[model samples]
Target: MLNGKVVAITGGFGQLGVAVVQGALAAGAKVAALDRAPAPAAASNLGDALALGGLDLAEPDVAARALDEVARKFGGLDALVNIAGTFRWEELEQGSVDTWDLLYRVNLRSAVSTSRAALPHLTRRGGGSIVNIGAGAAAARAAAGMGAYTASKAGVAKLTEALAAEVKDRGITVNAILPSTIDTPANRADMPKADFSRWVAPKSIADTILFLLSDSARDITGALIPVSGRV
Candidate 1:
């Protein structure tokens, strides 16, 4: 579906990120997987996808450099997937303000900085798609311990809307996928007794993201689509 497309995905070393990278590659796109974590030791599964690690995407200079490298390697950029984020369960009363700051930096700021960096390249391609990973919790009311995480994710949702409008005339589209508790290994271990069947799968989210990036959804932008799997 993405043949000849050059796509870059942030947080590409994690479970969901890995799924998206593989899916994009299968769709015949030149993929670049950027992450703050170290590159995986056995990345043969990533095929010819470029794996760039130790990037702090919240920093504008860092994000710009990373994306510049991707554009240099791929010849151009056509899509971006912002999946770098973190979650913390803590009540405001018990949590340090630092938690909120950390979430903001990692979740919202990272997306903003990376998207800003990618704009020139995407514009040079005449158009491109940007997909962000938001949270279903943020779309709805926050639970007792979800204030910080939800707040950060809500910022991401708002960024999608605002940036989409700002770049629509430039032929760039921006959207976000709001997912419920994803059924990853870490989530399973955290909620061992929970019904794993109800949680969304990483591949499910990846498929939705791929659709958003393709020409099939070229007219869709600024949409905060919910991809909750019965959650």
Candidate 2:
């Protein structure tokens, strides 16, 4: 479904990000994998299937540089998946301003900076797609120990909506996936006793993102689709 497309996936070294990259590559899209960490071992499997880069999406200039580098390397940019995020589990009483700021930088500002940087390149391509990874916790009422994380994701949701509106006329489609609990290895390890069967798989979410990026989803924008699985 993604053949001949050039796709940029942020947080490409992460479990979910890697799955998305692999899926896109399998579907025949040229992929650029960007993350804050150094390239991961998956690059070997990608061979010419992927290009990897280190990027700090919180810094606007760095984000711009990363986008420029991707465009230059890939020859063009068609889709951007903002999957980079940090999870902070802390109570309001225990969470300091620093904690809030840290989450804001990673979860909120990073998306904003990267999206801003990718806009022109997407426009140059005559239109592209942006899929943000959001959280279901953002839509639900706040939990006791997730104030900062929830707030940051709420910001992401709002940003997705606003950006979609801003770029609608330009032919860019911006959307978000609100996942409740992703069944990643880390999550399974963190909660070994919990029911992992109900959690959404990374590949499943990646498929939804691929669909949103496809030409068939041209009319879908400013929408936050839930991918909770059975959770």
Candidate 3:
């Protein structure tokens, strides 16, 4: 059901973002994949989709220009997935203030800036969807070393709720997905002793995100859908 939709995904070069971009294309949507890092060589031939790199989503003005460019190139814009964010593990006392600052800039700022940029274009479509990636870890009582990261993702959850209320009348739906321990290679490396089977798969998360962006989920907004795989 996303056929003909022009969807944009931030953090498009990442493992999870790569899953999302490929899935969106498979579902017959025109896609614009944006990331601070360049696209992998394997993604060079994405048929007609746009894959751009080095575009910082933290800068609202730059994000607005890029989204406008996407609309111009893709004919129109329909959906955006703010999957760009960073993760850090550090206790409050052990962490430098810079860690907090870095987390906010990379996680919260990216989503806020890009969602603000994409809102008008989505509204121009009469209605559209915005899906954000939040961590389930953020909702639970803070783990010993997750203070900075959790706080930033908590901001994302709040942003989703508030923005959904703001744009409900405009036909734009804003929502966030909270996933616990995504089964990515990086996570596997970081937590080598953990059970990988319990972690959520990138493909599973991508499928859910795609569904949220489809017409079927048009009535769903401000929902923080959790995709934890028994974690």
lDDT values of the candidates? 0.95, 0.89, 0.91
Candidate 2: stretches off by over 4 Å: 41-51
In model 3, which regions exceed 4 Å deviation?
42-48
Alpha-carbon RMSD, each predicted model: 0.8, 1.3, 1.3
Mind giving the per-residue lDDT tens digits that candidate 2 earns over 121-199?
9999999999998899999999888899999999999999999999999999999999989998889888899899999
Please give each candidate's TM-score: 0.98, 0.96, 0.97
Residues 1-231, candidate 1: write the lDDT tens digits: 999899999999888999999999999899999999987776455677899989999999999999999999989999999999999999987789999999999999999999999999999999999999999999897889999999999999999999999999989999999999999989999999999999999999999999999999999999999999989
Best prediction by TM-score? 1
Error of 3 at 55 (Å): 1.0
Q: What is the lDDT of residue 114 in candidate 3?
A: 98
Model 2 residue 27 lDDT score: 83
| Model 2 per-residue lDDT at 98 | 92
Candidates by lDDT, descending order: 1, 3, 2
Please provide, for model 3 over 1-231, each residue's C-alpha lDDT reduced to its tens digit, 9 standing for 90 to 100: 789999999998888888898899999999999999966565364445698888989999879988999999998899999999988888878679999999999999999999999988888889899999998988899979898999999999999999999999999999999999899999999999999999999999999999999989989999999999989
Q: What residue pairs are clashing in model 1?
A: none
